[model samples]
Target: MAGNGSFWVQIMPAILFLQLLFRAVGTDGASSFSFANDCQYPVWVGVLSGATSPPLARSGFYLPPSGTFQLAAPSSGSWSGTFWARTGCAVDSSTGRFSCATADCGSGDVACNGRGPSPPVTLAEITLASPGSGGQDFYDVSLVDGFNVPVRLSPSGGSAGECRAVACAGDVNAACPSDLRVVVAGSGGVVACRSACDAYRSARYCCTGEYGSPAACGPTNYSQVFKTACPAAYSYAYDDASSTFTCVGASNYDVTFCPRT
Candidate 1:
């Protein structure tokens, strides 16, 4: 035939160069080993042996050297580290520090600046009294551990006077005053009421059990005038005008006594 086609084309180029020398020594010559330029030899040798990269994610919100991780408003001062994804982080207004650079990745607007100090306004503990000579004045405030949340005692002006007294006046029978001279304070001191008086004269002071009728003064006309002058021990008085009353525990605590006029 053409000498057997030149002996099968010289044995097919020596069996295709021994199958390219056993594929350069096999495992397909480690896919032609590479070194960079978009690397590719087992993923650039598993990223130079430290294996693949892309890790480091932790930010549920905790930047408290003093406070201020998100929008900055916890006294406006003191802050700390770890904010990566594109790096470029900074902030050190004198001492409230925060930094980033080494092996960074910290993405966008990584925050933190000079911030800290602003959250304090809670005052309560008032006291004022004129428990009754009359003009119906009484305000003795003190409430500790009594109102945990829902509280709204707003009387920026008049008539809030007695903070709405309720608690003693003979358990709601009303008509108080046995020389009612109450004066308790709170927030941490002065609350001596060792029975100076108040056996019961406080239905807000009078719906009468005795006190010169004007219906014994109840509908807030406030005149128990000390139950008509210390009926037995508790007395009440109010009359600013002819609000009407004659309660007289020896009458004279500066006597104006609720006549309301």
Candidate 2:
């Protein structure tokens, strides 16, 4: 009996080793992303994966008021992508095409299908690190493309300071510059705001040519309008210093559109 007990203990270590190996192989490094629409009206959520990253489960979908959708990143590697809300979307009676008044991707369908949004969009961008890589996740709310709806990116399950939520829940369209305002035809009510670069393709506003460098390209009066409204959002091409945010060991992220606070 004593010899049998000794033999069992010796084999137990090997069994434990095999169990750990199987567990590691079975686990995929994926993160959950929850998209919530808090707007009074319905909004279509659009997603575009980064050039090197794999596409998420759903590229785009119609989200009714107070509705939510969730997606998981590919487990093969780190995932990078941008999410935006397309407001006032519907199937065109004439063309039978799906389109949005703001942030339309021009796909004529619910899925963006590898297409990016047309500017005048509020973008929530994120790059999630692979599991066990010891790398931090990077995320931000960008108005550099433009502003259609208020957005907030909130990370959960990370260390306190690094997991802080970043948001730009301001009414930018209301104060949009006259030249940059995107107004609805009937009511002439401003629905979106264009970035200076989108409004005018000047080298200065576009951050190209001599103004390409961050040192040379400072914020213009146009960008200041966006910055003043959404302080945490990226106002211009070179507004990286304050706009970028990072998190370590986060389990998931909640992206809310038309966030209350």
Candidate 3:
């Protein structure tokens, strides 16, 4: 009996090592997103899953200044989604409903419950690769909806070159054009910047009708302003050539709100 006990103890270590090795080799290719709030004020983060993708555990949550939260992607298959931050959020005393000065999801609560954010919001978009597909991950920071906060999306443990960090760390609201600026009452501050499409709603700016194609719709003066402020971000709907980034295999990503320049 004593001899048999020693034999089992010796074999246990070998079994454990094999299990760990198998886990490393058979990774599910799922990724994790780390959300960080670097701003001086608190921000409410909102997430909206793509139509074909599964929703995350919490669609929205409050993140205090310098706070961090991590969420893992679904391991079953590919996932795609967009994340953004809502600023100046507070419960309305009269109505007892939650709202934000910018990028409100209109859920009347802290959780967005799968609702997409309003315009004049900065967006971080990602489409993760499927397991064993050998496909690349696509990510970008888009200002096509507008700019409410500066965001940075950086890949970790991924391939080089195109997997580099992309950010819209510029203060676009301060330099926003008069017609495109969103000013909050009482405070009287330019809290967000509206896109030309959102502000004008014209065929040329909205890229509809005859200007639907990329060839027909080129960068306009309004988009150039956003491009000059944050060159790595998608300034307009067709700003794909320089905005989109790809990574071969990133274990995790850091999405920082109000990221430093």
Candidate 4:
């Protein structure tokens, strides 16, 4: 048998090669997000880096049916951002511009630049672990603004047993009340649903001013409807008690569009 020093020397090159590969992939024992579209139609996926943080990949990209896009985390050590799906997209033949009927970012093209999402969108949010915590990431599905599609956030090959997976996998559009429904243009069908705050725009529904505090902003009947439909998502602004999930030492995550069957 070779001595311990000799054995390590023989394997050092292989170990160094793996380290380089991991860094190139952007999951070098750190955290990253991978997006996939399972819908039968193309989907424009928008990525927004957290405020005060730098962006990783392109702001937006067109994902063909069953296509995938993987992005390594930003080099900023700790980062946070939101991801959403835009459907019913098409290029304006006359103007040669890209647009989507749902989750439109109002940039008049596939790329959203730095625009925030329009209402009636399902959002997946991730905040990587801080350096002090030895690396634990927080993730969630949020319907606080509303729901236009189903989304699932799953952690893969990581130290995330309790973290598990979270999804708002229901078609809230079909269940949306007439007063809160957003009908698509061509189909005239409910392709998206709005929150009570968005639909009503009242202080009560929006939890503003006197209702802004967590103690003041208890769940209302309108918010209960969304919570019942999506127990794992943030139904309203103050619905943070059970809506957040944490993963320790995770390698990467996969965010899926149209995750529900």
lDDT of each: 0.23, 0.89, 0.91, 0.83
lDDT of 3 at 180: 96
RMSD of each: 35.9, 2.8, 3.4, 5.1
- For candidate 1, what is the TM-score? 0.14
Which scores greater on TM-score, model 1 or model 2? 2
Candidates arranged by lDDT, highest first: 3, 2, 4, 1
- Backbone clashes in candidate 4 total 0
Model 3, position 227, has a per-residue lDDT of: 98
Q: lDDT by residue for model 2 over 51-105, one digit each (tens)?
A: 9998888899999998998998676578899999998888989989999899999
Query: TM-score-based ranking, best first?
Result: 2, 3, 4, 1
Backbone clashes for every candidate come to: 47, 0, 0, 0
Which regions of candidate 3 fall more than 4 Å away from where they truly are?
A: 1-30
What TM-score quantifies how close candidate 4 is to the native fold? 0.85
Best by lDDT: 3
Candidate with maximal TM-score: 2
- Compose the digit string of candidate 1's lDDT tens values, residues 1-69: 999999999899999998887665432100111111110101100001011222112222222222222
Q: After superposition, how far is residue 69 of candidate 2 from its true place, in Å?
A: 1.0
Weakest 10 consecutive residues, lDDT, candidate 2?
22-31
Model 2, stretches more than 4 Å misplaced?
A: 1-8, 14-30
Cα deviation in Å at residue 180, candidate 1?
68
